[model samples]
Target: MLELVKKNIHMNRWKTQVDTQVTLDDDFIVPDTMSDIAQVILDSGEVQLEPARVQSEKVTIRGKLDFHVLYRKEEGGLQTLGGLIPFEEMVNVPGLEERDYVSVSWKMEDLNAGIINSRKLSIQAVVTLEVRVEALFDTEAAVALGALQKEDDGSGELTFPQIATKTRAVNAAAIALRRKDTYRVKEEMTLSGSKPAIGRILWMEMRLSGALARPLDGKIRLEGTLLVFLIYEGEGESETVQWLEESIPFSGEVEMAGAVEEMIPAIDLRLVHKSIEEKPDYDGEMRELALDAVIELDIRLYEEQPLEILSDMYGVNRELTVETGEACFDQILTRNAGKCKISEKIQLSGGQRVLQFCHSSGLVKLDQAEAGEDMLSLDGVLEVKLLYLTDDDSCPIQSVTELLPFHYDAEAPGITKDSVWYLEQGVEQLTAVMAGGDIVEIKAVLLLEVLVLQPVCQSVILQAQTSPLDRRKLKEAPGIVGYVVQEKDSLWDIAKRFRTTAEHVMETNGLTSEELHPGDSLILVKEIVR
Candidate 1:
């Protein structure tokens, strides 16, 4: 018989896999009715994946990519082309059964679109997808604290040692909520005295600046803003290219039952269905426009689970058997933010003057991260790219790329070196200005979200040793002998086999660690006689 104690435990875990070789190859030809293609520009692209279908041997996934293409026509000035390409593939994963939850994400890079001739175009892009499968459950473990009754012939009664324990909060429950809303924007603008009405829209982009979600009694309130920028050509004598900007605010409520203010919400916003039709009006020598779009917000809700964990235990009088398991729990959630800027004093290579830039794009990447007791240290690089036109009043556009190194220290309370963290970074704003000379100033905001997890070990006592009344056992001789260590050998197992304690063997062998090689020599002194 053995002593028993019970405690509540919570565990949350997920295993993720990434596939980068998702083939994305498609070709489109310029219609013979339209003008010839002069220059092809890649504005932006996004991939949308459906829920994964799991089978016995492999999983099937289907998705589509939406990309906008800008082409300068040989006869016409500029034209915008949009296309939707569908793709599907199968991936082999062992032990992947049906009814398993799978979350998917994908990114596209290194896109190349070449114009073979004025009528034929070829496009190729590389896509990477990440899938995470997760499951949550609750369980209990029984631990051994102490016992008072025992009978020993050669040993006296001993008290039980203190048992180490750990407490944590895991994922108790989770749910998903989805909502879609529409936005309407309209504004009046003015051009130069010689500029004409808006003839055509060259390129347009929409990026989320900031978003927040808070839970109510039975609903979730969401708030955010979208930054809309566009490049349009004026119907003037020179047909100049103009840059325009607008910030649209949106707020709404989503229905979610049993949701409280203490729960955590993971937000994913997408342009599931949208239409940005342009209606330009000509007033004397200026241009006015209106924009409209529909956006969707997908959120994941999670509840915290608190647990008490048993770490270590032992028995002095009789042999003890312990059953242990491993689990992971959430530790902390903190938002880190900072502003980093890069300013340089340089001149143009040639005698070209600098016109107004279209837009500044920024991307952040983390190279290394370290965690301390109360803070996190991060090392990363910020890459900035700008597109600008020269002073020749021509239609040629030039581009430049820059890299900035940065280090940030974020305060994380109650975080230790043993915890694991997951990070997601976003850019708040990016701007570039022509400072005095050919010098350019670039400024950006960096936002980081971290999720920390702590792993715990749970143990329970299964059985205790039974004493035999008959004393007909073999004995060991007391002597000091030298033994050579071999593979698959441990000091604890050797001491138990020789009827000696591990402490006495270590004191005699002068060993610092238990790392024994095949040719290492050890001295064992057996002093117990039975």
Candidate 2:
């Protein structure tokens, strides 16, 4: 009777599934010109001499003059040679009767002068000097003789090396001059540029076409190569990666200290040649701008992703594949500045399953979508959330049967019901033992698939049962008997097929080896008898 009752009992079970898709935001665009600007100053006019010395032949004369030198920096700051003299243009005048000396004085004046504006003026000048020599002689005859000789000898080389001779000298002094004078200056001027933007100036060649005057106009022509730094932000917590750092030749024009009210137009530039370098950590700091200066920039954009995922997996068992794509942007700047991009991921759960997806790694292009489709065609892992299945006692068949009552046939006397019947009965009993079986507890597992998709935020959930099965027939079916092993059949696979334990098969076959030869027969004992 027990066997018959068991045979009439039933068993029940459940399964869950989930799917997800990711997309990018399109609200962001390249910033416009004039957004990034700051004050700038080029403090000018500091002079330095290489070596200070007098002519070796005129040691006793002690003659030296300063090379009045100065730099016209961007800022209008003055530096001067206060007490030092230029050694190149110094001279000694022969005195008369051993009692006379030459005296010299110097001054500067602007030959061309003009008013630049209400607050500033432009000026250019040449320096001039004067010299005087006077003589005193205790012997009038010696002074007279020296005066007579000075007029006769125009070469100025004294004939007698050790004579007490002095000669009166009067002449315009020689002076050493710089290349040019007068530097352009802007009043309360400010300068600025962009950082963490596309492109870099590789080799800059600048030439001053016109001379700069104090508080006036100046211009320069610039030419160079720019290496473009491709910037990209990720979808999630992943950081922005630079795919390409390339250099391209470019050229443009520059002007400074124009009319104070005149605005400088943004210069348009272009690249003429291409070159590339591998710089992994270059510009890691988004805020720092290298090679600070205002110059026209030309850039070459690349379609490549720099990050390479080494490996990834979902949970402890499931392995995942990764996918990648690249994009780029280009622009110009007067100075250096930095910028940023953002991304996010969402997660949801139901019963014993979870679902997850992310919008990371900047914009998703059509090619990336096509690549994903190709992966699907090639049996590649999908870049979506997985449904994790966790086994819990709360959802036992016995508990399910008790919650949803079902009819069962009574066992007849003398004959036992099939093993399938007994199995069903066991499932019902186990399900009834579970408390409040209506709500099944679910768990989730997250995973990443390297080379498939980076920063893939994924999750799995336990969904509710869709259809309930009858357990009566399951209890009446004949149990599987010993069976021959196939070429690739495993103990776990065989056990699952018969709802039996691997231990039973090992013990029944007396199998000391885990390796099973084809055609080998093994016994199967059913674990869950309905």
Candidate 3:
């Protein structure tokens, strides 16, 4: 006879489509006729991955991204061109079962653009798509009652609770903020003594500063400064570029139940639509610029749950053997982040003399990660683009791509090679200057956040029960027996080996605890009621 045990376990699954290349082509007409092109820049690209379908040996993901291409026309103005690129990719993930929860995200690593004609252009980009899933599996478990030591009473029954463990990545909240605000200012500096008329807006950068996300009143309250930086071509006898910076205070609320400051919240913001028209009201100079922008934000939260499990058990003293089940459990051992800074002088490429440096900006992307005994090593790239003046005073933009490698080891001593990692690299501060030998001396502070997950395989007891004694093989035993404890021996094992009760053995030997030492003498007195 055997006891039946039942348990539930939670686990996580995932698939990745990393290092995938894609092509984007567009044929757009500018306001002015085709001529010499000044510059081509990708304003923004976004992808929204749909739900994934898990197959026998793979997972299928489908999504589309909206990309924008901005260029300068020969007639001293900027042109805006855009198109939507649809994509589909298949990833191989072994042992994927149905009925698993899945989440997906897409990221852009590198993009290269070229001019095919006056109104036609071609762009290529490397995109990475990742899918993660959470699932629940049911299992059985049981432990046997102690083996019979005395004569059968035909009155004792046994019972045990059903115990199981499940691990899962739960979504805490989702936040969507719609902000419609205005910025009234007369602060940006003009190129000449007089305010030259604004020619064309070249590029704009939106950054969130001093941002705080907290849960309150069954909703997520976000407070931060929406910083807007604008670069434009100031119209004059000679074409000149001017810069304008503004910090617009914004406060909004979104409904997110159970959202707190500790749970990980990933925010993705986009300038869905924007309109800025210059309005100079009777000042005889440009003073007020009406600002209107539609900001779209997508926020998803995730939390990890890890637990301990119970496997098998058997009755003592009675004849019994336990059956166990084996499985590979995937769990998030540790998921955390830390703040870091990387300071180094980046060497310039060749004989370019620096007259003056205008502005510096960059993006940090994690490429790969590896784990040691107690540390996690991360590798990534910092795509830095600088706008500066040459010795000849040419204002063409010069870009540089550099590698940023770092190691993170703190409060982590159990990290192994099979651990999976993630990063949310943020650029806190980036300051630079032109050195004596034309080197770009840079001082950058970064928020190097990391997430580590280590999954291990363990076996648990499935079921156990007592093996009945045969009446035909039963033999009459003597009233007393002599016993000697040996090395690596336990009271329960000794009692089970001698077919006697542990309590009777301890009481007879004058034992105080469950401990037994080698060469210790004991007397076993059996009180059978046959």
Best-fitting candidate, scored by TM-score: 3
Q: RMSD for each model, in Å, please?
A: 9.7, 47.5, 7.3
TM agreement with the true structure for every prediction = 0.66, 0.17, 0.69
**Candidate 3 versus the native: TM-score?**
0.69
* Models ranked on TM-score: 3, 1, 2
Ten residues in sequence with the least summed lDDT for candidate 2: 1-10
Model 2 stretches with alpha carbons more than 4 Å out? 1-290, 293-475, 512-515, 528-530
Per residue, candidate 1 scores C-alpha lDDT tens digits across 323-379 of 555533444445444444444433445456677787777667676789976777888
Candidate with top lDDT is 1
On a 0 to 100 scale, what is the lDDT of residue 68 in model 1? 72
Candidate 1 is scored at a TM of 0.66
Candidate 3 local lDDT, 1-530, one digit each (tens): 44343334433323332334444444444335444555673355666566677787567878776666656665645556666677778876555557655455666765656677665666666677755544444322222233333433222433232212222322211122222222222222233445455666666665554444444545666666556666666655534766666767667776665655554544444444454555554644454556665544444444443333444333332345656676554444565656566666777774767666656666767765667668776666665666655554332444444555544443446788776555556666767786668677777776665555555556655655455443333346656888888999978777665666677788888888988899998897754422
Better of 1 and 3 by lDDT: 1
Off by over 4 Å in 3: 1-9, 14-19, 23-35, 39-98, 116-120, 133-200, 207-227, 233-240, 246-254, 257-312, 316-323, 327-332, 349-356, 389-411, 464-530
Which residue pairs of candidate 3 clash?
5-141, 9-165, 9-166, 10-166, 10-167, 147-318, 311-460, 311-461, 312-461
